[model samples]
Structure formats: structure tokens, C-alpha cells
Target: MAKYSRIIAQAGCHIHHAEPAQVYEAWTNPELMKTWMFLSGESRESEAKADVTEGGAWSVVNESQEETYRAYGEYLKIDPPERIEKTLVRKETGGQNEKIKVEINSILNGSQVIVTQDVVFLHHEQLHPKTVEEHLREQRRQTEKYWHEMFSLLSKQLTPS
Candidate 1:
């Protein structure tokens, strides 16, 4: 067994108009993920590839006028419409990687979804914000903002006009 100390960041949201299955699909489906996965509003995903089974590999590439970002990971666990655990490495950020666990629970008989994400950073010093507390707080804030935006986009995709 390996022992590691990590900084943990968590965020959650209740999606009013989507089911746990739909949420899981959006997260695991490459084509759907390309629509929203980054902070920059102008940035677009060039590639979003995933082998969505346990021990499978995944990668995503986002591009903007200024720069390009790439991330890759491997699934450690998967439970349909419920949970997934993976390790994600950001290539552009000097190979910094983290373990990401996501859970999607049904709230209203599959009509509403509750999504939660836990990100564990093994190399705390590599992350910005100076201290563990600051790093966790900043990561939480950013995760909340980004996930809200992503869910908003997913909502649009699920309920197109």
C-alpha cells in the first residue's frame, strides 16, 4: 500500500432538470464534454476522448486563441449513474495530477440530480494559493463556478429549444 497526504477539495450541485443517468452520460461522453469544461468562455474543447470503463483511459484538450490545455486520466472505478473515480493529469501544468471522484445521485425519481466532486491533490505545493487552506478554498470556489457553468450548458443540451 502507498501512503500519501493530500489536499481535498469538494463541490456539489443540484441540477433541477436532469437525471443521474443523464448527468453521468454527459460526464463520460466525449462529444458532450467538449461543450463546456474550462474556465475561459472563449475556449473550446478540441478533443474529449474517454474509455469509460474501470481502468480505462481518458483525455481532453481545450483550446483558445492564446493557449491550449490538455488533460488525461484513467478510471479507477465506475458505478453506472452513481459514481466514478479517476486520476487526472494536466499536461500543460507540468504534469500535475489529482484523483477525482464524482457521484451523481437521483433526487426526484430520476428527474432531479445531485452531483458531487472530490478532488485530491497529492502535490499541494505545486498548486497555487500558497497554503493548504487557501488552496482548498480556491479550488472549491473555482470548482463551484465551473461546475455550475457546465451544468447550465448541460441543461441547455438536455432541453434544447
Candidate 2:
């Protein structure tokens, strides 16, 4: 078989202070999403809207100190507090098209959220597996960092004053 691209980046964490449903809501609820959505370290969300149903549309405007842009897509699958799969688009991705699958499961006293992005390759050239793996490792690390930051923000919002 010919390889067009190799893309697999995964990140997850166990938040012992939040429940599965609460963690899921952070991704499905537009309002909750706005609180943690970040384009950069100092960036914040300007707008977020989602229908939260299969085939429903979702969009977010991420504003950083340097720039602002919109990322929009549709929900491919939504399974309550267990899982969600959706398409995501960004300018730098070249509409490379990707499916972001978020899985939430109940843990000891909180929740575990795992996010995986399947990046679609645009170029039709065959790349070496080692090369692909190295690239994915860096991407995975960066993605994991972002998710952790987002979750931290969500946790703060869910905490009592």
C-alpha cells in the first residue's frame, strides 16, 4: 500500500477533581468552551457556538495577542459523557482536514479525557515512518500541553468561589 501521510497525535490526563460529565461539558457546551479555548499562551476566545448534536456545526474564534482567526467544523459523533468525534479546521492546516476524537471516562474521583487528532495529509508523497513518528511526537507533546492548559482553566471555572 502507498502511504500518503502518517498522522496520529494523542494526549490525555486524569483530572481527579472533575467528573466525567463535567469534563465532557467543557468540550460540548459553548459557554464552557469559551473559558478554556486558547490559541496561544496569552490568547482567549472571542466567540464559541455549537449545536452539540450529530452533524451539528461548531465554530470558535481564537484571539491571541498577535492575531485572531476562526476554526469551524461539525460534530461527527456525540455519545454523551463518553465520547465525541468532530472535524476541525485551521488556516495553517491547509484544510488538511482532521478528526478530533475526545474520550472521557470516569476515574477514581474525577475524569480522564483523551484527545486524539487524525491529521489528513494533502501531499501525496510517501514519507519515512521514522520521520513521521518524530514529527508526530513533537505534535503530540505540543497538543498535550494545550489540552492540559485548557483543562486547568476549566477546572478553575468549575471550582467554587
Best by TM-score: 2
Q: Once superposed on the true structure, which residue ranges of model 2 sit more than 4 Å away at CA?
A: 1-4, 120-133
Clashing pairs in 1: none
lDDT tens readout by residue for model 1, 89-130: 764234555777777877763434444455443443444445
TM-score of each: 0.75, 0.81
Write down the lDDT of every candidate, Cα atoms only: 0.68, 0.76
Best by lDDT: 2
Clash totals in order: 0, 0
Task: Supply candidate 1's per-residue lDDT for 91.
Answer: 46
